[model samples]
Target: MAYPFKEILQRFWGYTSFRDLQEDIIESVYLKKDTLGLMPTGGGKSITFQVPALAMDGICIVVTPLIALMKDQVHNLLKKGIKAAAIYSGMRREEIAITLDNCIYGNYKFLYLSPERLETELFLSKLAHLNVSFITVDEAHCISQWGYDFRPSYLNVGNIRKLKPNCPVLALTATATLLVVDDIQEKLGFSKKNVFRKSFKRENLAYKVEYSENKFNRLVELLVQHSGSGIVYVRNRKMTKELAEFLTRNEIPASFYHAGLDSFVKDKRQKAWTENKSRIMVSTNAFGMGIDKPDVRIVVHFDIPDSPEAYFQEAGRAGRDGEPATALLLYSKTDVSNLKKSFTNAFPEKRFIRTVYHHLMNYLQVAIEDGIGRTFDFELGKFCKAFALNVVQANNALNILERSGLIQNTDTRENNSRLYFLAGKEELFGFQNQRQEYEELIKTILRSYSGLFSSYVYISEQTIAGRTGLSNEQVYQYLVNLDKAGLVKYIPQKKTPTITLLKDRVPENIITISKSIYEEQQERMKRRVDAMLYYISSDIICRSQILLAYFGEKKSKPCKICDICTSNGQQKDLSGSIRKAVLDKLNRTGSTNINELIRDLTYDKEKSMEVIRFMADNGDILLEDKQIKINS
Candidate 1:
């Protein structure tokens, strides 16, 4: 039987049709079948579960790792008159209780939450009470150790399934290898044959890898050539700012986005870019998830990503509107060497990992067998400075600990600003009269927000600024003043990561990092780096084909628009010119060295070398180290 899902999709998302496997996945879920969806980024992954949940009988519980994305989806659903809520880390116990209770009693159609919440006793207690229709796991690849971004918390999803034994499950991921796909299904408890995978091919997106020494100049040229909104992905937060500033100085309307920025600033920058106030976003990998902007004509990787899965997802952010688009990866020999070194550095010694753990316990003043299940505001830089530890090594050590399930780290930028009024309305009356300076601000707060006296409320300074006609800074100052005056208890927004101890502090000698697991993870990472390097240096295969093959798809035809295919034509023409020049010069000089030919050529030395190497490899010439001779 056909459901009214098309009508529902139109009502909520205003889309007339579902993309690729969306309708099939939705149908399977609505029919109560365990399903796994493998759609590329921007392939309407949310609609598969959301539309079905809307058509189903009870609330759908969405498990995702991204807390901000969870809240964003809930907010969007609420705006469309669909009751939805999310519970994540940093939320008060009371808030979580209320949200879970609402899911049980308030007829909420959706309850989005992080996978970490599944293991909590409170969530487990409420899980038995929720009238769960189905469970949707986004970023399903994270459950597998083989996946590019593994999260140990996702392992608890199986526990959730035990609570609601009969509820069907839908696992969603944008990029997953064959290994990850099988792992997700097994981990999620798929009942039977239930996998829906769309091809990883994006026909309209031309994947290009260009060798360029001057990346910034090439970036400007590409941005000018492709006249539309785009994303420039860089490796580090500092580079995001620097590259964005450089682009702006070169007259490109650009803004930088990273997890380090205040939530309000991040939102403002994102909004400006999304609305076309800025034509480009220079960002870290954190910027792309759940962003629905279409018509992005280009996506340039300023630095190579850690894996092909990550690269595919990041590049897939372009051309969502289905128009022609370019995904350009700037390549250099230096990038490859540096990336390998960085990966090596990212995995510190096992002894170093244990030492960092010891120092972390000491830094937080936690004694052995104490501080279990406690969350602390952890600043890596501060901890490193205090303990005389290298920041990079410390970070890697923390990651190893996290992978070992010793601790959990939450970036506090993901935490929302919270406020609570300490004084009741009547009690504030005297203070309001005494301090006329804060009277209007206090009045505006009371008028605009609800339940400020009862609990700490998640507040948006931007919303307050709009309501009170004050700048965000001014609004923050007012909250700080209220806190200082003892009229309110305000927690200003956090920009550092929060570390939560999953288990009690143990003896440093007792801590263990699994040798097999560590080796396996390193091998996987090495394979990914090799794949990315192969994509960069390969001139024979289609760029799109290489990506497709990496994801376990075979026999993909060449995308004619990619650099490899297009350059194939130019390469032939350029090969003829270079061959003649080299032959002409060789004949005149009677087999000179390679360096002399390079000096004699008017073309770029790099291009000249590449041409000479290509000719030698193809048997038109013979290269013996520094010497070049025409093959007899």
Candidate 2:
């Protein structure tokens, strides 16, 4: 039977056709086969699952690592009248329970969950009860160590097969190397027969690199020359703010985006940029995922990214509408040093990792097996002050721990709320009955949550404490005691996001810096920088050919519209007459001062400088200070 995907596509998303590779990926998943999708950033990845899920009978579960993206996708689906929901780190227990129940019994077609949620018994058990048709892992490259952004939570996805032995898996990413692709397939348990990939080539984007002493002025010139909307990517949050301010002061309509901004501000700025209310956005890497703006004409990288994967993904954000667009990178020699510093900052010393791990375990007051589903309020500065560890070292250790998968880290800006049953309730409660104190808490929860017996509801702990006339501490103690009893669930209200380390402690002997890994990363970084430099320095190759080759494609000729190709024909006329005069002078004298050479030839100082610069750039002549030598 045909999956009726075409009909579903029109009925739901109102698209008359599938964008390239969407149909193939959808067909693969619909047949209960595994797939690896390598579509570029704006290539309609969501439709690959959304259309197929509508045709299937059971729920399609999407595992995403980004909380903001989860919410955005869920909201979009909900607006389209599709039954969709998400469970993320900051949600209350009742909220999660209700969303899960909706998936089990309601007409929900898609359910989204954070990768970190997969480790919980509560989630795993409830997930087993749901009739899930398929599992889609977004940003699938994160499962591989070779990927630019590797998350430890992504590693836990291999266990999903244990829960649903036969569910087809679909892995998706915008950018992945051969190593990352292989790692994703192996980690996700996809059979060789099931793997699928699209080529990583964007033909319409014109790649150019300008080699000038002043890149900032070059950027301003390009922005003024370009017609449509644009994006400028910087490596740090501080640069995002500063560059956006600088452009605004210069009267360009621009805004800045980064993770440090409040959600409300970020959302407002993002919307303004998306809707074209703002012509350009200056941002850190935080700005691009799930963004659907199709007419971005230019994408400029002010600083080099650490790897090619990150560079491709960020640059791919441009030219989605398919009209001619430019991807430019402004890199200097210092960018390499900056990138090395960033890598070191991202992975700290193993001793620091162990210290942070112990501190977290002590703060939570629980052993390894007992801490699942428990939430803790974490303040990094306070922890650093108490432990006497450098803040940078502590933060890096926390990052490594999170990567190791010992805990769930919630990094959202919203404050989370904690809830537990006033007394134990029986029917809704499943799992975690192993402890006795939890049984009493479940009893208390049952009596307390009257509405929970029938349906999910949010109740404030203060209200329960008020009714019981217990002090806040006593209420919390009883809740913790009940949580230990497994009768009532307790969720701690998180004011800030916590970073969960994958390991309780770093191994003493483990090498954080290996020569091989360092060399490999250095090579990847060098490729990106070289590509940028090639765009700036190459005069013979077509700008398009250079760019296409970087993404693993080969084009035969230059794009006629690029500055070099367009100027080539006219350049001969201007250079022919000047070349004759220069050659005659060179024949008369072996070498001469540039001023004397120009004066003898009657060329203006500006024209003399231009000719020398071009010759030096193209390697036809060598210049050292005022002296010039013709190449033999």
Candidate 3:
């Protein structure tokens, strides 16, 4: 029963012990049992599968929804000398083929692919050939329409059980409600007895909400006062850019990131922020999925998120290094209105969905059956123009279609080529000798790469362009020409996450409403608003205690560092008689001013206010203007 996990840990990652539930998860996988991991952000979720993959007999297949996360995890695994490879949209075809071939030949221990990519014949065929030990689905809540970040592709995970019936499945996510947890198990086809859940709580983060008319100004003051890396999340791309600009104008080194940015630019900005070249990043929800920057001191939400699940996940990103961190939300009545507007925008009418569905089919020039394995470039504006549909309606329809799973949208900057040499060193040298014009380029590539001969490599075309003094386009074309000349094989890269809708374009009348989906989204929003209100109104509970309880954890005492616990010196727990006296004055006097109430009660002003607040919190008093009234 003994394994070399400890040796594997020390030899590769230089770690000695497992974090929280990682060892338990690894053990479960080893025992061929299903597991559901609910570790918080920065809890080392990656190691749960990684250690097990190394210890198991066959390759582990990880299905993730984020392309950025897949690439980052694969890169880190390779750095540790683990045989891991990821098949994502931005990779060239030859690279994918080589990686798939490696899996088929048992040369890789872990294979990461997008859940959307599971339907492809090429991937499925090769996957059938490989002996997969277990399947791990990250962000498992996305499978349920009730989840905050629902995706239709996640529904295909159940089919993995059909493909490899003997293999167990592990579902992992940071946030999920009781209902979401149930749906994930059902949707992923896990047996009832196999599910395992860890507590979802972090004790180090202090959560608080500030109510103010001028939230931006408040944010600036807080940023200037707080020292360390921070993130400010806005709801839209425009706000992300504007807030970052405002912060920079105020002399805070800041950057902005969103899905709308070009990949290269997004990569650069993310690198700058992660490396501490920028201390702050104002971003939309798209920014933090795969990022693991540990020492974040604060997380501010300029606008409320759509649901509590999202809010908890984003807030959990703070204080990951276990030092005390602050989670602040600047709340205004307008944020609630804006959030309602967003919900309407996300869920459109059925006619609109059909219109956009037809447009997409026509734009791609494919029939229903033929579209399953097809991939195409998508232009939102062009498609809208062609159908004479409003841009918002058209975009929302496409999103619905993507959620349903019909077509794959490969959105990227432009078409580009990449090369992966197929020959051994001696054969490559022979080819280079015959093709003398390309000798410098070949040598440059070889010098820049570390394991070019034995492993599948990711050479930066930008670096090759720099060394050869050629435009990126020129370098790409040269690589394609070399492939045609049989010097090396090449494939064009795809840049977007492959999106496939499960059903073809159906009529508006045929679309069925899932009450669970609607109710779930509504409840999610309610939970977030409740959390915001809780942080602002609570007086006796510690800020950290409130947050931890929301995430399903209990703490016996306050953390002492939070605003409530720290202010204990200035305040005392009022006696029940004093609380009743405060309520009685409010009820008898009816709308009297605060100063008059203090005088009438014959109590000090500070203690009187504290008693009034305590009565209000206990639902024994209602405050209006400066006066308080007892509940009827």
Candidate 4:
């Protein structure tokens, strides 16, 4: 009994055919074989697992480290009438439990969770109860130690095989080295070695690196040259706003984006950029994941990225529509040392790490042998000010602890106010009858929102207040009161990062940064920094080749469209060789077809055309009826 996969594609996506290698990967998963798919950044990686999972009988479990991607995909799937849910950092334990239970009983088609969730005791306890079709790992390179963005939490993605032994795994990544490829397959416990690769080449996208002292002018020049939608990636939140303002001052339509912005604002600005209402978006690296804008004509890096993988993925955002575009990097003097300093700041001394951990525990008020499974909102600026610590080093230390799996400090995420009715309708009616004072608010809530009884649903206190003629504070109090009465579980909206204690708090001396998380990881960061430095400084190698080789594409030919090749083009002596050959051919034949002459020339075809254009411009040749003739 097989489902019509092609019909499923048309029914869901309204597509006549699959993109390159999508069908094969889908077919491979349908056969229940573990697979590693290396797709380009904009390649349709989601379709591989989605089509197959929809055809299969049970829910598909998708694991990814990016919360933005989880929310984006879940929202999109829900819009398509596909039952989906997401569990990631910052979600309440109750919400996670409810979502997992729904996945078990509600006939959901997809459940997206972060890799860290896989190792949680709650998730582990519920694993055996799920009727899973398969597990899909996005950004699978994180599981490999050799990968640039390795996370110890990602290791637990492999442990699921023990519970769902027959559920095949599909791992997808935009970029991976040969070593990473093998490591991913082994770590995931693939039954046999199988890899599906889409070429990383972007023929229409040109990669460029520019060196100039006046960076702002260069940026303006680029914007003027390429008249279309673009992205400008900087290094910090401040830079995003400043650059965007500057661009706007220069008469360029621009907006800024970063994680710190309110969720509504972020969505609004992202929408503006996507719809071409804003011609340019100046942002930090947080802006690009899970966005589906295809006509991006250019992506400019105002500052260098940390690793080749990061750079490649960011730059690859352009030319997504298979049209001509440019990925330009502006290199400056200070960037090199700044990147090197970042590596040192990323791995503080072991003693300092322990010190930071102790201070964090004190800040969160977690006593020894306690605090496990509890989450506290962590404000870095406040904590650093309190401890008189360097913000950069303190942040790095927190990351180290997170990688060590002692705690989880995630990025700032926004959660809307949500509530779930714990009691059935009859019980709620009885409770409302008893509590007549809350009757109006309850009725308004029931009229305004749906799905509260079955699961959590977004609720707005202000909107409820407007409708009920009550103050916003009054509405909030009523919701809290209802939660306290055990009739509802209500959580207020928040935009803060939360640090969850993964293990029991211990004395400062007991905190140990393992070698894998510290020393070796430092070496890896150094190598990445060095790779970035080498990429910008070296002028002879094709930029594309350098990036491709870094990803284990050793046999790739030079792109010929990168900065190095074009620079070589400028220095190439086409006048001496191609010039005389064209003259001799024209003199012998008197005149020849311009295409035929360049096609017949043995020299480089592009160089030959350049020489022909030079002759035509300098009055050395005559063009008539698509033929070339020497000036008489």
Estimated TM-score for each candidate: 0.85, 0.72, 0.81, 0.84
The superposed Cα distance between candidate 4 and the true structure at residue 266, in angstroms, equals: 0.8
lDDT tens readout by residue for model 4, 407-513: 98876555557789998889889988998988899989988775678777656677788899999899989999999999999988776788989999999898777
Stretches of model 4 off by over 4 angstroms after superposition: 1-3, 421-450, 458-488, 568-632
lDDT of 1 at 256: 94
lDDT of each structure? 0.85, 0.71, 0.73, 0.86
**TM-score result, candidate 4:** 0.84
Candidate 1 residue lDDT tens string, 1-632: 75898999998899898888889999999889999999999988889989999998999999998877986787678668788877877777877786788689888899888877888889988888888999999999999999988888899998888879999999999999888899899988888868898899998999988888888888898898889999999988999989999999989989999988877788888899899999999999889888989989999998888789999999999998989999999867788788898789878888898899999999999999998778898888999999898888788889878988899988978877877787888889998898776777778877765556644556788877887788889889978988898888887777668999989999999887886357778888899998888678766556887788788875566678888778848654554566679999987877879998989987767767866765564456788879988787
Model 3 CA deviation exceeding 4 Å by range:
89-97, 192-198, 367-370, 408-418, 431-437, 450-457, 466-474, 492-632
State the weakest 10-residue window (summed lDDT) of model 2: 450-459
lDDT for predicted candidate 1 compared with the true structure: 0.85
- After superposing candidate 2, which stretches have Cα over 4 Å from the reference? 211-216, 358-373, 385-393, 414-495, 501-632
Q: After superposition, how far is residue 388 of candidate 4 from its true place, in Å?
A: 1.1
Sort by TM-score, top down from the best: 1, 4, 3, 2
Report how far off residue 41 is in candidate 4 (Å): 0.7
Write candidate 2's Cα lDDT for 49-136 as tens digits: 9988988889999999887787678767866778787787767666678778878988789988888778766787798789988999
Query: What residue pairs clash in candidate 4, if any at all?
Result: none
Q: Cα RMSD for candidate 2?
A: 10.7
- True lDDT of residue 484, candidate 1: 92
